[model samples]
Target: MANKKRQTEFLLMLDKYQGTIMKLCLVYTDRHPENVKDLYQEIVCNLWESYPRIRRKNNIPTWVYRVALYTAYTHQRSRKRSVPFIDLDDGFFETVASDSGNEMVERLYSLIDRLEPEDRTLLFLYIDNVSQVRIAEILDTTESAINHRIKRLKQKLKKMNENEEEQ
Candidate 1:
């Protein structure tokens, strides 16, 4: 009975944060719905497994975001070894065309994809309006470190955009 109650409570907590999870998945998957679904399931499974270890309400969002990022990174790494880019259909464009009003989202994701995994996670959280302190907690880094990384990432992304525009 205790286990069931805990499970129910955890599910409720997750339900409250489902939109955040979906958004993170969308960001990581580059708006590919299929990939988003896959990553979402992976994140949920991870969160459920780790639920018992979560002790503070304040930490839940950060914990969930970190798990989602890690899951996406692992999934990408595994897929890279076995699957070639040509084998996978790029469905993100179609999905974005149908659902999004902001055309810049595609361009933004393209730039984000060029970043390293750690930078991508930092930027994604930053874009989602997470604070530097919370991001540091999630990443197990200092706030100054997170700030430094964001600064470097922004400069790199700016250069990439300028290069793209020149082409």
Candidate 2:
């Protein structure tokens, strides 16, 4: 009974944050809907398996985000070779095409897609409104290090955008 209650509570908590998880997956997968769905399932499964061990020692949201990020990164790395450059399904393209946001969101995600896995993780956390302190905790880096990386990423993204504009 106790285990059932705990599990129910955990699922409820996860349900409340599903949108955030989906958004993170969307961002991490470059809006590739199929990969987004895959990553979402992987993240949820990881969180469910890790929930019992999470305990009260860590912030649940922070821990969940960390797990999601790690899972996405690992999945990306493992599939890199087998995955084609443009493997997005029709649904994936539809989601991206339907996005009402200005070109900046698309451009930003394009730049994000170009980053290395770890860099993409950092940028995803930063964009998710996660605090620098929380991001540091998630990435196992100091806040100063997180700040530095964010700065450098911004500069690199700006340069890339400029190059794209000039092209």
What residue runs in model 1 are displaced by over 4 Å at the alpha carbon? Answer: 82-101
Stretches of candidate 2 exceeding 4 Å from the true structure: 81-102
Give the range where candidate 1 is weakest over 10 consecutive residues by summed lDDT: 84-93
TM-score for each of the candidates:
0.83, 0.81
Best-performing candidate as measured by TM-score: 1
Candidate 1 lDDT by residue in tens digits, 58-148: 7788888878778888878775665433223446534532456666876776777777877888888898899999999989999999989
The true-versus-predicted C-alpha distance at residue 75 of model 1, in Å, is: 1.3
**In candidate 2, what are the lDDT values of residues 19-111, reduced to their tens digit?**
778777777764656667677889889998888897674488788887887887787776675664555556743574356587887777777
- Model 2 scores a TM of 0.81
